[model samples]
Target: MDDDEHLLWQRVLAGDDDAFAAVFDLHASRVHRQARRLVEARADAEDVTAMVFFEAWRRRRSVRIVNGSVIGWLLVTTTNVARNRERSRIRYEGLLRKVRVETVPDHADEVLDSFMRPAVRGRVREAFDGLSTRDQEILALCVLEELAPADVARLLHVPAGTVRMRLSRAKSRLRAALGEDHGRSTLAGLGGTS
Candidate 1:
Protein backbone atom coordinates (compact mmCIF):
# COMPACT_ATOMS: atom_id res chain seq x y z
CA MET A 1 0.00 0.00 0.00
CA ASP A 2 1.25 3.47 -0.87
CA ASP A 3 0.49 6.82 0.75
CA ASP A 4 -2.34 7.61 -1.69
CA GLU A 5 -3.96 4.20 -1.45
CA HIS A 6 -3.84 4.33 2.31
CA LEU A 7 -5.70 7.62 2.33
CA LEU A 8 -8.24 6.29 -0.13
CA TRP A 9 -8.81 3.24 2.03
CA GLN A 10 -9.35 5.45 5.06
CA ARG A 11 -11.97 7.37 3.13
CA VAL A 12 -13.45 4.18 1.80
CA LEU A 13 -13.81 2.87 5.33
CA ALA A 14 -15.52 6.12 6.22
CA GLY A 15 -18.25 5.21 3.67
CA ASP A 16 -17.03 7.43 0.88
CA ASP A 17 -18.31 6.01 -2.37
CA ASP A 18 -16.15 8.32 -4.44
CA ALA A 19 -13.04 7.09 -2.68
CA PHE A 20 -13.99 3.51 -3.33
CA ALA A 21 -14.64 4.33 -6.96
CA ALA A 22 -11.25 5.97 -7.17
CA VAL A 23 -9.69 2.82 -5.82
CA PHE A 24 -11.61 0.84 -8.41
CA ASP A 25 -10.40 3.15 -11.16
CA LEU A 26 -6.86 2.63 -9.92
CA HIS A 27 -6.95 -1.16 -9.70
CA ALA A 28 -9.67 -2.42 -12.04
CA SER A 29 -7.43 -2.93 -15.08
CA ARG A 30 -4.84 -4.95 -13.17
CA VAL A 31 -7.60 -6.93 -11.49
CA HIS A 32 -9.14 -7.84 -14.82
CA ARG A 33 -5.76 -8.75 -16.29
CA GLN A 34 -4.98 -11.04 -13.38
CA ALA A 35 -8.48 -12.46 -13.58
CA ARG A 36 -8.04 -13.19 -17.27
CA ARG A 37 -4.79 -15.06 -16.53
CA LEU A 38 -6.63 -17.10 -13.92
CA VAL A 39 -9.97 -17.81 -15.64
CA GLU A 40 -10.18 -19.48 -19.05
CA ALA A 41 -12.96 -17.31 -20.42
CA ARG A 42 -13.19 -13.53 -20.67
CA ALA A 43 -16.79 -13.31 -19.51
CA ASP A 44 -16.13 -15.40 -16.44
CA ALA A 45 -13.17 -13.19 -15.58
CA GLU A 46 -15.28 -10.07 -16.01
CA ASP A 47 -17.98 -11.54 -13.82
CA VAL A 48 -15.41 -12.42 -11.21
CA THR A 49 -13.93 -8.93 -11.24
CA ALA A 50 -17.32 -7.28 -10.95
CA MET A 51 -18.39 -9.59 -8.14
CA VAL A 52 -15.14 -8.90 -6.32
CA PHE A 53 -15.86 -5.17 -6.24
CA PHE A 54 -19.48 -5.78 -5.29
CA GLU A 55 -18.46 -7.88 -2.34
CA ALA A 56 -15.87 -5.30 -1.37
CA TRP A 57 -18.56 -2.63 -1.23
CA ARG A 58 -20.93 -4.87 0.70
CA ARG A 59 -18.28 -5.79 3.22
CA ARG A 60 -16.50 -2.47 3.38
CA ARG A 61 -17.45 -1.87 6.99
CA SER A 62 -15.90 -5.15 8.03
CA VAL A 63 -12.85 -5.16 5.76
CA ARG A 64 -9.49 -5.73 7.41
CA ILE A 65 -6.75 -3.86 5.58
CA VAL A 66 -3.47 -5.68 5.53
CA ASN A 67 -0.49 -3.45 4.72
CA GLY A 68 -2.97 -0.67 3.87
CA SER A 69 -4.20 -2.27 0.64
CA VAL A 70 -7.74 -3.48 -0.01
CA ILE A 71 -6.76 -4.70 -3.47
CA GLY A 72 -5.13 -7.72 -1.81
CA TRP A 73 -8.48 -8.58 -0.30
CA LEU A 74 -10.24 -8.07 -3.62
CA LEU A 75 -7.79 -10.31 -5.49
CA VAL A 76 -8.31 -13.14 -3.02
CA THR A 77 -12.06 -12.62 -3.26
CA THR A 78 -11.77 -12.86 -7.06
CA THR A 79 -10.36 -16.36 -6.74
CA ASN A 80 -13.37 -17.54 -4.73
CA VAL A 81 -15.91 -15.57 -6.74
CA ALA A 82 -14.55 -17.00 -10.01
CA ARG A 83 -15.04 -20.53 -8.64
CA ASN A 84 -18.63 -19.73 -7.72
CA ARG A 85 -19.18 -18.31 -11.21
CA GLU A 86 -17.93 -21.53 -12.82
CA ARG A 87 -20.14 -23.72 -10.65
CA SER A 88 -23.13 -21.55 -11.44
CA ARG A 89 -22.33 -21.70 -15.16
CA ILE A 90 -22.18 -25.49 -15.01
CA ARG A 91 -25.47 -25.70 -13.15
CA TYR A 92 -27.13 -23.27 -15.52
CA GLU A 93 -25.94 -25.20 -18.55
CA GLY A 94 -27.31 -28.39 -17.03
CA LEU A 95 -30.68 -26.73 -16.63
CA LEU A 96 -30.64 -25.36 -20.18
CA ARG A 97 -29.91 -28.78 -21.58
CA LYS A 98 -32.66 -30.33 -19.47
CA VAL A 99 -35.09 -27.86 -21.05
CA ARG A 100 -33.73 -28.60 -24.54
CA VAL A 101 -32.81 -24.98 -25.19
CA GLU A 102 -30.08 -24.42 -27.76
CA THR A 103 -26.91 -23.12 -26.20
CA VAL A 104 -25.95 -19.63 -27.32
CA PRO A 105 -22.53 -18.88 -28.73
CA ASP A 106 -20.37 -16.95 -26.30
CA HIS A 107 -19.73 -13.74 -28.25
CA ALA A 108 -17.28 -12.53 -25.69
CA ASP A 109 -15.34 -15.75 -26.00
CA GLU A 110 -15.35 -15.47 -29.77
CA VAL A 111 -13.89 -11.99 -29.50
CA LEU A 112 -11.27 -13.09 -26.98
CA ASP A 113 -10.25 -16.19 -28.92
CA SER A 114 -8.99 -14.09 -31.80
CA PHE A 115 -6.41 -12.41 -29.59
CA MET A 116 -5.47 -15.03 -27.01
CA ARG A 117 -5.01 -18.77 -26.66
CA PRO A 118 -6.38 -20.54 -23.62
CA ALA A 119 -4.10 -23.56 -23.97
CA VAL A 120 -1.83 -22.56 -21.12
CA ARG A 121 -4.85 -21.63 -19.03
CA GLY A 122 -6.36 -25.08 -19.59
CA ARG A 123 -3.17 -26.90 -18.58
CA VAL A 124 -2.79 -24.83 -15.43
CA ARG A 125 -6.44 -25.36 -14.55
CA GLU A 126 -6.16 -29.10 -14.97
CA ALA A 127 -3.36 -29.19 -12.44
CA PHE A 128 -5.27 -27.01 -9.96
CA ASP A 129 -8.48 -28.99 -10.35
CA GLY A 130 -6.70 -31.81 -8.51
CA LEU A 131 -5.96 -29.80 -5.38
CA SER A 132 -7.98 -29.34 -2.19
CA THR A 133 -9.88 -26.04 -1.85
CA ARG A 134 -7.73 -24.98 1.10
CA ASP A 135 -4.58 -25.42 -0.93
CA GLN A 136 -6.08 -23.45 -3.83
CA GLU A 137 -6.93 -20.42 -1.67
CA ILE A 138 -3.50 -20.27 -0.07
CA LEU A 139 -1.73 -20.51 -3.40
CA ALA A 140 -3.96 -17.88 -5.00
CA LEU A 141 -3.34 -15.39 -2.20
CA CYS A 142 0.34 -15.97 -1.60
CA VAL A 143 1.72 -16.91 -4.99
CA LEU A 144 -0.65 -15.43 -7.55
CA GLU A 145 -1.68 -12.28 -5.75
CA GLU A 146 1.85 -11.74 -4.43
CA LEU A 147 0.49 -10.90 -1.03
CA ALA A 148 2.54 -11.31 2.14
CA PRO A 149 1.93 -14.43 4.22
CA ALA A 150 1.13 -12.18 7.16
CA ASP A 151 -1.60 -10.56 5.07
CA VAL A 152 -2.78 -13.96 3.86
CA ALA A 153 -2.70 -15.32 7.41
CA ARG A 154 -4.91 -12.46 8.53
CA LEU A 155 -7.34 -13.43 5.79
CA LEU A 156 -7.16 -17.17 6.58
CA HIS A 157 -7.29 -16.65 10.36
CA VAL A 158 -4.03 -18.53 10.97
CA PRO A 159 -0.58 -17.61 12.13
CA ALA A 160 1.83 -16.10 9.58
CA GLY A 161 4.29 -18.94 10.23
CA THR A 162 1.55 -21.50 9.69
CA VAL A 163 0.58 -19.82 6.45
CA ARG A 164 4.19 -20.05 5.28
CA MET A 165 4.39 -23.76 6.15
CA ARG A 166 1.08 -24.46 4.46
CA LEU A 167 2.23 -22.52 1.37
CA SER A 168 5.42 -24.64 1.17
CA ARG A 169 3.40 -27.84 1.45
CA ALA A 170 0.84 -26.60 -1.05
CA LYS A 171 3.58 -25.70 -3.54
CA SER A 172 5.06 -29.18 -3.17
CA ARG A 173 1.73 -30.83 -3.89
CA LEU A 174 1.15 -28.52 -6.85
CA ARG A 175 4.62 -29.26 -8.25
CA ALA A 176 3.92 -32.99 -7.99
CA ALA A 177 0.63 -32.50 -9.78
CA LEU A 178 1.96 -30.21 -12.51
CA GLY A 179 5.43 -31.84 -12.79
CA GLU A 180 8.72 -30.35 -11.63
CA ASP A 181 9.37 -28.58 -14.92
CA HIS A 182 6.39 -26.26 -14.49
CA GLY A 183 7.50 -23.19 -12.54
CA ARG A 184 6.15 -23.13 -8.97
CA SER A 185 4.49 -19.74 -9.44
CA THR A 186 2.70 -20.88 -12.59
CA LEU A 187 0.59 -23.17 -10.40
CA ALA A 188 -1.03 -20.01 -9.13
CA GLY A 189 -1.89 -18.97 -12.69
CA LEU A 190 -4.54 -21.68 -12.51
CA GLY A 191 -6.62 -19.33 -10.32
CA GLY A 192 -9.23 -20.90 -8.08
CA THR A 193 -10.14 -23.79 -10.39
CA SER A 194 -10.61 -26.21 -7.50
Candidate 2:
Protein backbone atom coordinates (compact mmCIF):
# COMPACT_ATOMS: atom_id res chain seq x y z
CA MET A 1 0.00 0.00 0.00
CA ASP A 2 2.99 2.25 0.29
CA ASP A 3 4.48 4.19 -2.61
CA ASP A 4 7.27 1.66 -3.10
CA GLU A 5 4.81 -1.27 -3.31
CA HIS A 6 2.60 0.68 -5.72
CA LEU A 7 5.57 1.46 -7.95
CA LEU A 8 6.77 -2.14 -7.83
CA TRP A 9 3.31 -3.50 -8.68
CA GLN A 10 3.04 -1.14 -11.63
CA ARG A 11 6.42 -2.20 -12.94
CA VAL A 12 5.69 -5.87 -12.32
CA LEU A 13 2.39 -5.63 -14.16
CA ALA A 14 4.21 -3.91 -16.95
CA GLY A 15 6.37 -7.04 -17.38
CA ASP A 16 9.36 -6.16 -15.27
CA ASP A 17 10.92 -9.29 -13.73
CA ASP A 18 13.09 -7.21 -11.43
CA ALA A 19 10.01 -5.54 -9.99
CA PHE A 20 8.44 -8.93 -9.34
CA ALA A 21 11.59 -10.14 -7.61
CA ALA A 22 11.59 -7.02 -5.45
CA VAL A 23 8.01 -7.70 -4.42
CA PHE A 24 8.87 -11.32 -3.62
CA ASP A 25 11.84 -10.30 -1.52
CA LEU A 26 9.74 -7.84 0.44
CA HIS A 27 6.77 -10.16 1.12
CA ALA A 28 8.13 -13.70 1.27
CA SER A 29 9.00 -13.65 4.96
CA ARG A 30 5.57 -12.48 5.98
CA VAL A 31 3.96 -15.05 3.72
CA HIS A 32 6.04 -17.80 5.26
CA ARG A 33 5.14 -16.63 8.76
CA GLN A 34 1.43 -16.73 7.97
CA ALA A 35 1.81 -20.20 6.50
CA ARG A 36 3.70 -21.34 9.57
CA ARG A 37 0.94 -20.09 11.86
CA LEU A 38 -1.75 -21.90 9.91
CA VAL A 39 0.05 -25.21 9.28
CA GLU A 40 2.01 -25.36 12.53
CA ALA A 41 4.96 -27.01 10.83
CA ARG A 42 8.09 -25.32 9.53
CA ALA A 43 8.62 -27.67 6.58
CA ASP A 44 4.99 -27.52 5.52
CA ALA A 45 4.96 -23.75 5.90
CA GLU A 46 8.05 -23.42 3.71
CA ASP A 47 6.44 -25.58 1.04
CA VAL A 48 3.23 -23.58 1.17
CA THR A 49 5.10 -20.31 0.96
CA ALA A 50 6.95 -21.50 -2.13
CA MET A 51 3.70 -22.64 -3.74
CA VAL A 52 2.09 -19.29 -2.96
CA PHE A 53 4.78 -17.39 -4.85
CA PHE A 54 4.63 -19.92 -7.65
CA GLU A 55 0.91 -19.32 -7.98
CA ALA A 56 1.46 -15.58 -7.83
CA TRP A 57 3.82 -15.85 -10.75
CA ARG A 58 1.38 -18.01 -12.67
CA ARG A 59 -1.47 -15.57 -12.05
CA ARG A 60 0.59 -12.40 -12.28
CA ARG A 61 -1.49 -10.96 -15.11
CA SER A 62 -4.70 -11.36 -13.15
CA VAL A 63 -3.39 -9.87 -9.92
CA ARG A 64 -4.61 -6.33 -9.38
CA ILE A 65 -3.40 -3.63 -7.02
CA VAL A 66 -6.80 -2.04 -6.58
CA ASN A 67 -6.16 -0.82 -3.03
CA GLY A 68 -2.44 -0.18 -3.65
CA SER A 69 -1.55 -3.41 -1.75
CA VAL A 70 -0.94 -6.99 -2.80
CA ILE A 71 -0.52 -8.24 0.77
CA GLY A 72 -4.15 -9.29 1.23
CA TRP A 73 -4.00 -11.40 -1.91
CA LEU A 74 -0.70 -12.89 -0.81
CA LEU A 75 -2.08 -13.82 2.59
CA VAL A 76 -5.16 -15.46 1.15
CA THR A 77 -3.05 -17.46 -1.27
CA THR A 78 -0.76 -18.57 1.53
CA THR A 79 -3.74 -19.71 3.59
CA ASN A 80 -5.08 -21.80 0.72
CA VAL A 81 -1.68 -23.33 0.15
CA ALA A 82 -1.35 -24.19 3.82
CA ARG A 83 -4.81 -25.73 3.89
CA ASN A 84 -4.02 -27.87 0.88
CA ARG A 85 -0.80 -29.06 2.45
CA GLU A 86 -2.56 -29.90 5.69
CA ARG A 87 -5.25 -31.86 3.92
CA SER A 88 -2.68 -33.82 1.95
CA ARG A 89 -0.74 -34.56 5.09
CA ILE A 90 -3.86 -35.78 6.82
CA ARG A 91 -4.76 -38.06 3.96
CA TYR A 92 -1.24 -39.45 3.77
CA GLU A 93 -1.20 -40.13 7.49
CA GLY A 94 -4.51 -41.92 7.24
CA LEU A 95 -3.17 -44.10 4.46
CA LEU A 96 -0.09 -44.87 6.47
CA ARG A 97 -2.23 -45.88 9.43
CA LYS A 98 -4.39 -48.13 7.26
CA VAL A 99 -1.27 -49.79 5.89
CA ARG A 100 -0.09 -50.53 9.47
CA VAL A 101 3.01 -48.41 8.91
CA GLU A 102 4.60 -46.72 11.84
CA THR A 103 3.50 -43.14 11.32
CA VAL A 104 4.31 -41.71 14.72
CA PRO A 105 7.60 -40.12 15.58
CA ASP A 106 8.61 -40.46 19.21
CA HIS A 107 8.96 -36.73 19.72
CA ALA A 108 6.39 -35.47 17.24
CA ASP A 109 3.48 -35.27 19.64
CA GLU A 110 5.61 -33.64 22.33
CA VAL A 111 6.96 -31.07 19.93
CA LEU A 112 3.49 -30.09 18.77
CA ASP A 113 2.23 -30.12 22.34
CA SER A 114 4.85 -27.59 23.40
CA PHE A 115 3.48 -25.03 20.93
CA MET A 116 0.77 -23.86 23.35
CA ARG A 117 -0.45 -24.02 26.91
CA PRO A 118 -2.46 -27.16 27.47
CA ALA A 119 -5.71 -25.62 28.71
CA VAL A 120 -6.00 -22.63 26.39
CA ARG A 121 -4.83 -24.55 23.35
CA GLY A 122 -7.16 -27.42 24.15
CA ARG A 123 -10.14 -25.09 24.39
CA VAL A 124 -9.27 -23.28 21.18
CA ARG A 125 -8.79 -26.55 19.35
CA GLU A 126 -12.15 -27.73 20.63
CA ALA A 127 -13.77 -24.57 19.32
CA PHE A 128 -12.10 -24.98 15.96
CA ASP A 129 -13.10 -28.63 15.74
CA GLY A 130 -16.71 -27.74 16.34
CA LEU A 131 -16.97 -25.43 13.32
CA SER A 132 -17.99 -26.57 9.87
CA THR A 133 -15.22 -26.92 7.28
CA ARG A 134 -16.40 -23.74 5.57
CA ASP A 135 -16.39 -21.84 8.84
CA GLN A 136 -12.94 -23.11 9.71
CA GLU A 137 -11.50 -22.11 6.35
CA ILE A 138 -12.93 -18.61 6.48
CA LEU A 139 -11.72 -18.09 10.04
CA ALA A 140 -8.23 -19.16 9.08
CA LEU A 141 -8.22 -17.04 5.93
CA CYS A 142 -9.51 -13.88 7.58
CA VAL A 143 -8.48 -14.02 11.24
CA LEU A 144 -5.33 -16.11 11.03
CA GLU A 145 -4.07 -15.04 7.61
CA GLU A 146 -5.28 -11.45 8.09
CA LEU A 147 -6.89 -11.21 4.67
CA ALA A 148 -9.66 -8.72 4.14
CA PRO A 149 -13.12 -9.99 3.22
CA ALA A 150 -12.70 -8.97 -0.42
CA ASP A 151 -9.36 -10.73 -0.64
CA VAL A 152 -10.80 -13.82 1.00
CA ALA A 153 -13.68 -13.75 -1.47
CA ARG A 154 -11.25 -13.47 -4.36
CA LEU A 155 -9.16 -16.38 -3.08
CA LEU A 156 -12.13 -18.66 -2.34
CA HIS A 157 -14.12 -17.72 -5.46
CA VAL A 158 -16.96 -16.38 -3.33
CA PRO A 159 -18.72 -13.05 -3.26
CA ALA A 160 -17.45 -10.39 -0.87
CA GLY A 161 -20.89 -10.26 0.74
CA THR A 162 -20.76 -14.00 1.30
CA VAL A 163 -17.36 -13.66 2.93
CA ARG A 164 -18.68 -10.95 5.27
CA MET A 165 -21.69 -13.06 6.20
CA ARG A 166 -19.69 -16.22 6.74
CA LEU A 167 -17.04 -14.42 8.74
CA SER A 168 -19.71 -12.94 11.00
CA ARG A 169 -21.21 -16.35 11.60
CA ALA A 170 -17.85 -17.96 12.24
CA LYS A 171 -16.93 -15.29 14.74
CA SER A 172 -20.20 -15.69 16.52
CA ARG A 173 -19.73 -19.44 16.78
CA LEU A 174 -16.15 -19.13 18.03
CA ARG A 175 -17.19 -16.51 20.55
CA ALA A 176 -20.01 -18.69 21.83
CA ALA A 177 -17.74 -21.69 22.18
CA LEU A 178 -14.93 -19.84 23.92
CA GLY A 179 -17.15 -17.45 25.85
CA GLU A 180 -16.59 -13.73 25.25
CA ASP A 181 -14.15 -13.05 28.08
CA HIS A 182 -12.19 -16.26 27.67
CA GLY A 183 -12.10 -15.84 23.93
CA ARG A 184 -10.57 -12.38 24.17
CA SER A 185 -8.01 -13.53 26.72
CA THR A 186 -7.12 -16.61 24.74
CA LEU A 187 -6.72 -14.64 21.52
CA ALA A 188 -4.52 -12.15 23.37
CA GLY A 189 -2.51 -15.05 24.73
CA LEU A 190 -2.03 -16.36 21.22
CA GLY A 191 -0.77 -12.92 20.17
CA GLY A 192 -3.65 -12.61 17.72
CA THR A 193 -5.36 -9.72 19.53
CA SER A 194 -4.19 -6.14 19.26
Candidate 3:
Protein backbone atom coordinates (compact mmCIF):
# COMPACT_ATOMS: atom_id res chain seq x y z
CA MET A 1 0.00 0.00 0.00
CA ASP A 2 1.20 3.50 -0.76
CA ASP A 3 2.24 5.30 2.41
CA ASP A 4 -0.07 8.19 1.48
CA GLU A 5 -2.97 5.78 1.07
CA HIS A 6 -2.24 4.25 4.46
CA LEU A 7 -2.20 7.70 6.07
CA LEU A 8 -5.51 8.64 4.40
CA TRP A 9 -7.23 5.44 5.44
CA GLN A 10 -5.99 5.79 8.98
CA ARG A 11 -7.38 9.28 9.18
CA VAL A 12 -10.66 8.11 7.62
CA LEU A 13 -10.90 5.43 10.27
CA ALA A 14 -10.36 8.14 12.86
CA GLY A 15 -13.49 9.91 11.51
CA ASP A 16 -11.67 12.61 9.59
CA ASP A 17 -14.17 13.92 6.99
CA ASP A 18 -11.49 15.97 5.26
CA ALA A 19 -9.32 12.89 4.87
CA PHE A 20 -12.20 10.97 3.33
CA ALA A 21 -12.95 13.86 0.97
CA ALA A 22 -9.33 13.94 -0.09
CA VAL A 23 -9.46 10.25 -0.86
CA PHE A 24 -12.65 10.77 -2.87
CA ASP A 25 -11.16 13.63 -4.89
CA LEU A 26 -8.06 11.58 -5.62
CA HIS A 27 -10.02 8.59 -6.94
CA ALA A 28 -13.25 10.01 -8.38
CA SER A 29 -12.07 10.74 -11.92
CA ARG A 30 -10.48 7.37 -12.51
CA VAL A 31 -13.51 5.59 -11.01
CA HIS A 32 -15.91 7.65 -13.14
CA ARG A 33 -13.98 6.86 -16.32
CA GLN A 34 -14.03 3.16 -15.58
CA ALA A 35 -17.71 3.28 -14.62
CA ARG A 36 -18.55 4.90 -17.97
CA ARG A 37 -16.70 2.15 -19.80
CA LEU A 38 -18.80 -0.46 -18.02
CA VAL A 39 -22.25 1.18 -18.12
CA GLU A 40 -22.12 2.90 -21.54
CA ALA A 41 -24.32 5.80 -20.39
CA ARG A 42 -22.97 9.04 -19.04
CA ALA A 43 -25.87 9.62 -16.65
CA ASP A 44 -25.80 6.04 -15.46
CA ALA A 45 -22.05 6.16 -15.10
CA GLU A 46 -22.37 9.29 -13.01
CA ASP A 47 -24.98 7.68 -10.82
CA VAL A 48 -22.85 4.59 -10.45
CA THR A 49 -19.84 6.71 -9.55
CA ALA A 50 -21.84 8.44 -6.88
CA MET A 51 -23.18 5.11 -5.63
CA VAL A 52 -19.68 3.66 -5.40
CA PHE A 53 -18.47 6.49 -3.23
CA PHE A 54 -21.57 6.28 -1.09
CA GLU A 55 -21.12 2.55 -0.61
CA ALA A 56 -17.46 3.03 0.24
CA TRP A 57 -18.41 5.51 2.92
CA ARG A 58 -21.20 3.35 4.21
CA ARG A 59 -19.06 0.25 4.46
CA ARG A 60 -15.76 1.88 5.22
CA ARG A 61 -14.86 -0.40 8.09
CA SER A 62 -15.39 -3.52 6.05
CA VAL A 63 -13.50 -2.27 3.01
CA ARG A 64 -10.29 -4.14 2.28
CA ILE A 65 -7.59 -1.51 2.26
CA VAL A 66 -4.85 -3.48 0.63
CA ASN A 67 -1.60 -1.51 0.35
CA GLY A 68 -3.46 1.68 1.23
CA SER A 69 -5.22 1.56 -2.12
CA VAL A 70 -8.93 1.18 -2.70
CA ILE A 71 -8.77 1.32 -6.51
CA GLY A 72 -9.23 -2.40 -6.87
CA TRP A 73 -12.26 -2.44 -4.60
CA LEU A 74 -13.79 0.55 -6.37
CA LEU A 75 -13.34 -1.11 -9.73
CA VAL A 76 -15.06 -4.26 -8.51
CA THR A 77 -17.92 -2.21 -7.08
CA THR A 78 -18.27 -0.34 -10.35
CA THR A 79 -18.63 -3.59 -12.28
CA ASN A 80 -21.21 -4.94 -9.85
CA VAL A 81 -23.20 -1.70 -9.81
CA ALA A 82 -23.22 -1.52 -13.57
CA ARG A 83 -24.42 -5.10 -13.87
CA ASN A 84 -27.10 -4.53 -11.23
CA ARG A 85 -28.37 -1.46 -13.05
CA GLU A 86 -28.55 -3.37 -16.28
CA ARG A 87 -30.32 -6.31 -14.67
CA SER A 88 -32.85 -4.06 -12.97
CA ARG A 89 -33.62 -2.27 -16.23
CA ILE A 90 -34.08 -5.58 -18.03
CA ARG A 91 -36.37 -6.95 -15.34
CA TYR A 92 -38.46 -3.81 -15.31
CA GLU A 93 -38.85 -3.90 -19.06
CA GLY A 94 -39.76 -7.57 -19.02
CA LEU A 95 -42.45 -7.06 -16.40
CA LEU A 96 -43.81 -4.03 -18.25
CA ARG A 97 -44.06 -6.01 -21.48
CA LYS A 98 -45.76 -8.87 -19.72
CA VAL A 99 -48.29 -6.51 -18.14
CA ARG A 100 -49.07 -5.06 -21.54
CA VAL A 101 -49.54 -8.40 -23.29
CA GLU A 102 -50.88 -10.79 -20.64
CA THR A 103 -54.64 -10.73 -20.28
CA VAL A 104 -57.79 -12.81 -20.49
CA PRO A 105 -59.66 -12.04 -23.69
CA ASP A 106 -63.07 -12.12 -22.07
CA HIS A 107 -62.01 -11.02 -18.58
CA ALA A 108 -59.34 -8.47 -19.34
CA ASP A 109 -60.73 -5.98 -16.88
CA GLU A 110 -60.72 -8.47 -14.02
CA VAL A 111 -57.24 -9.73 -14.77
CA LEU A 112 -55.71 -6.26 -15.09
CA ASP A 113 -57.56 -4.89 -12.10
CA SER A 114 -56.43 -7.78 -9.93
CA PHE A 115 -52.83 -7.16 -10.85
CA MET A 116 -53.14 -3.41 -10.36
CA ARG A 117 -54.33 -3.79 -6.80
CA PRO A 118 -51.86 -2.15 -4.41
CA ALA A 119 -52.32 -4.85 -1.80
CA VAL A 120 -51.55 -7.62 -4.25
CA ARG A 121 -48.40 -5.86 -5.50
CA GLY A 122 -47.25 -5.20 -1.99
CA ARG A 123 -47.80 -8.82 -1.05
CA VAL A 124 -45.63 -10.00 -3.92
CA ARG A 125 -42.79 -7.62 -3.07
CA GLU A 126 -43.09 -8.57 0.58
CA ALA A 127 -42.77 -12.22 -0.30
CA PHE A 128 -39.51 -11.54 -2.07
CA ASP A 129 -38.23 -9.49 0.84
CA GLY A 130 -38.91 -12.35 3.20
CA LEU A 131 -36.65 -14.74 1.33
CA SER A 132 -32.99 -15.34 2.19
CA THR A 133 -30.51 -13.21 0.24
CA ARG A 134 -29.23 -16.20 -1.75
CA ASP A 135 -32.75 -17.30 -2.64
CA GLN A 136 -33.73 -13.77 -3.62
CA GLU A 137 -30.65 -13.35 -5.79
CA ILE A 138 -31.13 -16.66 -7.61
CA LEU A 139 -34.82 -15.96 -8.14
CA ALA A 140 -34.11 -12.48 -9.46
CA LEU A 141 -31.63 -13.89 -12.00
CA CYS A 142 -33.53 -17.04 -12.98
CA VAL A 143 -37.06 -15.69 -12.79
CA LEU A 144 -37.10 -11.90 -13.11
CA GLU A 145 -34.18 -11.62 -15.53
CA GLU A 146 -35.15 -14.91 -17.19
CA LEU A 147 -31.56 -16.14 -17.22
CA ALA A 148 -30.95 -19.82 -17.89
CA PRO A 149 -29.71 -22.03 -15.07
CA ALA A 150 -26.27 -22.37 -16.55
CA ASP A 151 -25.95 -18.64 -17.01
CA VAL A 152 -27.01 -17.98 -13.45
CA ALA A 153 -24.59 -20.62 -12.23
CA ARG A 154 -21.73 -19.02 -14.13
CA LEU A 155 -22.55 -15.55 -12.88
CA LEU A 156 -22.95 -16.70 -9.29
CA HIS A 157 -20.00 -19.12 -9.35
CA VAL A 158 -22.16 -22.07 -8.41
CA PRO A 159 -22.80 -25.36 -10.19
CA ALA A 160 -25.55 -25.41 -12.82
CA GLY A 161 -27.49 -28.05 -10.90
CA THR A 162 -27.26 -25.96 -7.75
CA VAL A 163 -28.77 -23.03 -9.58
CA ARG A 164 -31.65 -25.16 -10.77
CA MET A 165 -32.20 -26.75 -7.39
CA ARG A 166 -31.97 -23.43 -5.57
CA LEU A 167 -34.45 -21.85 -7.97
CA SER A 168 -36.91 -24.68 -7.32
CA ARG A 169 -36.49 -24.33 -3.58
CA ALA A 170 -36.82 -20.54 -3.72
CA LYS A 171 -40.02 -20.82 -5.75
CA SER A 172 -41.43 -23.27 -3.25
CA ARG A 173 -40.57 -20.89 -0.43
CA LEU A 174 -42.21 -17.99 -2.29
CA ARG A 175 -45.34 -20.03 -2.86
CA ALA A 176 -45.53 -20.88 0.81
CA ALA A 177 -44.87 -17.30 1.87
CA LEU A 178 -47.65 -15.88 -0.31
CA GLY A 179 -49.99 -18.83 0.22
CA GLU A 180 -50.35 -19.07 -3.54
CA ASP A 181 -49.90 -22.03 -5.84
CA HIS A 182 -47.23 -20.66 -8.19
CA GLY A 183 -46.59 -23.74 -10.25
CA ARG A 184 -45.95 -24.19 -13.95
CA SER A 185 -48.40 -21.53 -15.09
CA THR A 186 -46.91 -18.82 -12.89
CA LEU A 187 -43.36 -19.89 -13.67
CA ALA A 188 -44.35 -19.70 -17.33
CA GLY A 189 -45.22 -16.05 -16.75
CA LEU A 190 -41.69 -15.52 -15.39
CA GLY A 191 -40.35 -16.96 -18.72
CA GLY A 192 -39.12 -20.22 -17.20
CA THR A 193 -39.87 -23.14 -14.92
CA SER A 194 -37.45 -24.94 -12.64
Q: Pick the TM-score winner.
A: 3
Model 3, residue 44: displacement in angstroms?
0.5
By summed lDDT, the worst window of 10 consecutive residues in model 2 runs over 185-194
Q: Which regions of candidate 1 fall more than 4 Å away from where they truly are?
A: 99-194
Error of 1 at 170 (Å): 82
How do the residues 1-194 of candidate 2 rate in per-residue lDDT, one tens digit apiece?
58779888888878798988999999999999999899877887888888998888889877766577788899998988888888998999999889966676699567557745698688899998999999999888888788889999999999999998998788777777999888766655443433
Could you give candidate 3's per-residue lDDT for residues 1-194 as a string of tens digits? 38898789878888889988998998999999989998877999999999998898888887787666988888888889888999999999999988866665788667756654677667768888999999999999988887889999999898999999999999888877877564444555555554
Q: Evaluate all candidate structures by whole-model CA lDDT and list the values in order.
A: 0.79, 0.83, 0.83
Better of 1 and 2 by lDDT: 2
Candidate number with the higher TM-score (1 or 3): 3
Question: Across residues 145-169, which tens digit of lDDT does each residue of candidate 1 receive?
Answer: 8898999999889999999888888
Query: Which candidate would rank higher by TM-score, 1 or 2?
Result: 2
**Model 3 vs. true fold: TM:** 0.50
Worst 10 residues of 3 by lDDT: 182-191
Q: List the candidates ranked by TM-score, beginning with the highest.
A: 3, 2, 1
